[model samples]
Every structure is written in structure tokens, then in C-alpha cells.
Target: MRPKEIQEKLNIDGDRIKLFKREGIFTPENPPSGNRSTNYTDADCEHLRLLVVLTKSGLTCSDIRKLQEGECTLEEAIKIRKNNIDAEIKRKQNALILLSELLADKVEFETFETDHYWNVIAAREAEGEEFINTEDMYGYRAVSLIRSIKCPYCGEEHEVDLEDYMYDESSYEKENGMGPDVVYSFNSEDGYECHECGRIIQIEGWIREYPEGAYDSEDINVVEGEKD
Candidate 1:
């Protein structure tokens, strides 16, 4: 109620509390006159608590004042803050995966790469561990690296044009590597029929070593046509 008592209860600087009051955040129930000092009510304490939370969410004093004036609702501020936090989480996750692969001592090139590497990194970070014991799996991944392959179904060799989704590690490792490799299942437009047997074929692919000096360019075209 008294400034000293309010400061102790709110664990805030007396001046800070005074500023909020002066800025019309919440007025004392009974105004202090002459020797009588200002005292806050239970409601005032609750308002101060909300004020502290809003400030911690990166709102300025002016923003809080607007909130008090009903310029915006608390729900709106909360939604905005949540969206910002989600964006930051995605950014950090991307950085963790990219930097880990790029800075690895011996990065491997592969057609069927797995996010097992990134997932392990995420798991280790969750436990406050930063060391990556095995960097064997970390590297850039491309979608359906096979330009053409011999089909398993009809034994026919087919030319393949893959979509971008084929290269994602999570796509292959979805459900812990139980999901089917999408590259093998292609439409007629994306995959050619086997000429020898006249059967529509899903070709098997391989993981090959990435060539040296391939990382220098923006677009690294490692594999082309069928690997003989």
C-alpha cells in the first residue's frame, strides 16, 4: 500500500512503481493528502503484475499504456509474441543443421541422407550436450539424385525427373525410416518405362561420395543420367 510496502511486495523499484502511477496505469484507491501517504489496493498489485509480464515480453512503457487504454487486447499481444517465438525456433533449427554439415571436417555426399544427424543434434542439445560424436551422417541432401536408373519391377532403365521433396532427409526418415522412399514411386511423366520389358519401373538409387570443390558454387549438380 505504501510505496515501500508496494516495492517489497512487487519486488520492483519504488521509482518504477511511481512512474506507472504517474503515467495513469492505476491510481491508488485513497489519494494521500499532506502527511498521509499513497497506498495501493489488491487490484493495483494485480495490474502491476500484468505490467511486469508485458514488459518482459518486450513491450515498451507506451505499449503497456495503450494496453491499459484498451487500444489492444492482451490476447493479441500474446498471439504476436507466440508467432515471433515460433519463427525464431525454426530459424535456429535450420542454422543448426546447415552449419553442422558445412563445418564438418569430412562431409559426405549422399542421395539418401537422413535427418538422423540433425535429430541427434537436437536430442543432444536438449540434454545440454554440444559434442557431436559422429559427423558421418551430416551433409547436404538433394532430392532424387538419380537422373535415370534400372527399374526393379520390369528391369527397364528409366530417365527420372524428381521434385524437390525427394531430397529431404526427414521425408525418408519419416516414422523412423519406416516410410517408403518417395523417389522410387514416380509418375509416368517423372519416370520412364523400361524399354527391355515394357514394364513401369521404380528404380533403385545409391549414395555416392560428393566430389571435391563442388561446394563452391550455388548449384552443385553431382549426379546426372543413369549411373553405370
Candidate 2:
């Protein structure tokens, strides 16, 4: 077939035909002498038409040539594109989870003292106020702050240590008040006492109030009845 005939059939210019030859999509042994040459074939024209369609569908010129040469398959190309999309989605999901965990940690850290008031109680217990056992009370208080605590029942005392006394927060609320904030009647007669002796127990809980000059460091040495 003539070059002019092939160009008319493919609806392309002479330059594009030369480009197809340079890309090695289809080659003629004898180069076309001039603008008009009968060196092109019907098969060559049909190949150029297919190349144009593939290139228009987002395939690069090199990729189109490779596909025509049987070096790669269309299914492999599609799989590569999909894999890139999947990787991008996974990256975004990981970023979201990281942000959520960071926000949760920050919020928990800020309310650290409020959540663990049991630590304060433990500190007092270490200072020799022996009515309440500190080790047992710490676990109960911590769990209570986070969830709930069981009442210090008499039946379970012989079987387990105080730390083992677990109860749901709802049950504790039903028996005792919600927390130390709410004032409730204490059974002074049946309240927690020293296990070693029959002495009245003095278990220190959270303190919500302080004296007017309680935090003043300079007044530390000032006694109530002493002159400066």
C-alpha cells in the first residue's frame, strides 16, 4: 500500500507514521524515498489505528509499543494501577488510627491526677495510718475510678485479699454513694478497723478542702499560738 493511501485510511499525518517507525511499532525494510511511497502495508495501517486508541486511553507511547510487541499484558497493567490505589488507601487509614490514638493518650494524660486519687490514699497509708491496708485499697480504688469496686464484704475477707475484692461500678454505686464527692452516712460501728487489734480505724480518703494559708511555704514554721 502507498504511504498516501495508508495516511488517508488512518487519518494521520506523515510525521506520525515516521514516529511509529522510530518507536519500532511497525518498520519497513526499504525506507520511503519521498512523501509518496508504496512501501506501507494494510497491516501497518491497522496497527497504527490500534496504537492511537491505546495511547488515548492513558497509556504512554512506550507502553503502547511494549504492549504491541507482546512484552506486557493489559491485565498486568490494570493490576499495577489498582495496587497503587490500594497502597494509598492503607496509608490514609494508618494516619487516621495514629491521630485517634494520640488524641486519646493526650486526654487521658491531662486527667491523670483525677483518675488516680487512690495514689494519694496510698501515700497516706504508707505514713502509718494502719486502719485500711494500702496495697489492697490501691487496686480497688484504681479499678473503681476506671470502672467500679465491690463493697469490702465480710464473707470474702477470709477467702481473698482486699485486692481480689472486685465489684462492678454500678453495684458499688447502689451500695455506697457514687464517690468521695457525695457525702453519705458512714456506719462508724461497722466501719473498717485494724485487723490486728480492736482499735478504731482512721482511713484517709480524698480531701477536697484546704485551710486559707495551707499552701503558703513561709507559714510552714508558724504555730497557732507562737509569736513570730
Candidate 3:
């Protein structure tokens, strides 16, 4: 596993070997001469080959050094890289969904609006802020009002489609008509109705929201011939 032996095994030029060592990708204690050189094992040669491929694929020498030193497991590093890829995929999916809904005339505006309203409400609550006015329940913000609805009979939850339920008649009036003034209304005398299950029970709040993002790109197996 002298330099000459490595060069012969890899079918690479001496200059390439020199370059690899200069890049700190591969190193030998002593340079090979006509009759004197240190030996290298087959495992060392394989490791060097893998390093070359990794470096060519955009990994830096420092990254390789970290791997060599056991600072991070290769599995963990791969997982981190995959997680980032997954986040990007989710972002792209959301953007596509928004764009498609915008372009379609028969899109489910109600569902999207309701989900957005609840998200905002949840965000506010997470920040330790009140979404509703405790004194006058009716004097709350649209977001607050949307969050306060529960079926008196079925106990089914309902959310207001705030975006679709806008007061801007000038814009939407020409399209799919207008929404009700009160985003949510319940009849306590009669139990609320579940939209899905159709059960007659006491409603708590709106449960309809947007679907979670699709699978993470990292988790998705790459198919052969696919160029992603």
C-alpha cells in the first residue's frame, strides 16, 4: 500500500495522489520513492476512495475531519441533512397548495379560512395573550369570535373561515356571495350537529383545519431515474 501501489490500484496519476494528500483527504507519513515507502492496507485505500467521492459531492475537508474524529456520527449528519430537505419540501407543498387554491374557482375557501383563524388563535395563546375579551364576549376580535364556537347538541367543533368570511363585498360579492355577520352561532336549546359524524351532542369548538404537510423529502425514497 505504498504510494505506487495505491496509484496502481486506483489507476490514478501520481499528481492526483499528491493533490489528495495536499487537500488533507489522504495522508501517508512518508513519500514513496523508487524503493522506499510506507505500506497502506486495502481498507485505507477504500476509505480514501470514499473520501474522494464525498469531497466531490460537496463535502469539505473539515467535514471529513469531523467524521474522522468521531465528533458526529455519519447517521446523525445524514439525518440533519435530511431534516433540512424535508422542511424545504413542506414549504414547497404549502406554497403549491396556496397557489392551486387561489387559481381554482371551486376551492374549499371555508376550510382554509377556518384553519388559518385557529392557527392565529393558537399562536396568540402560546404567546400568553388572550384572543378574546373576557368582559364582553361579543366585543372580541374576529379571530376570538371564530374560536369561541361549540355545538350545543353534538359537541362537534366548528371553525370560522375568516379569510372567506370577509366583509369586503366589493371584491367577493361578484363571486361566491357573502358570509354571515356572525362567524359562529350555536343554539344551546338544541344540541349542536357534527358535520362529519352527524352526532347530536354538545359541541366544544371547531376542529376542521388544514391538513398537515406532506411527507418529508428525506423520508421519501429516491426512485431510480428520478432527477430530484
Give the runs in model 1 whose Cα sits over 4 Å from its true position. Answer: 79-228
TM-score of each: 0.33, 0.31, 0.28
lDDT tens digits, residue span 99-218, model 2: 575576674555665534456445644873323323323422121111122223221111111211112112122234333222111112223333333333222222121122122111
Return model 1's CA RMSD, one decimal: 27.5
Best by TM-score: 1
For candidate 3, the 10 contiguous residues with the lowest summed lDDT are: 214-223
Error of 1 at 109 (Å): 47
- The candidate with the higher lDDT, 1 or 3, is 1
- Tens-place lDDT per residue, model 1, 22-131, is 45675667654322356678887887888777777766566677777888887876677677566656556755766677667355666324576668667866976544
Model 1's TM-score against the true structure? 0.33
lDDT of all the models against the reference?
0.51, 0.42, 0.46
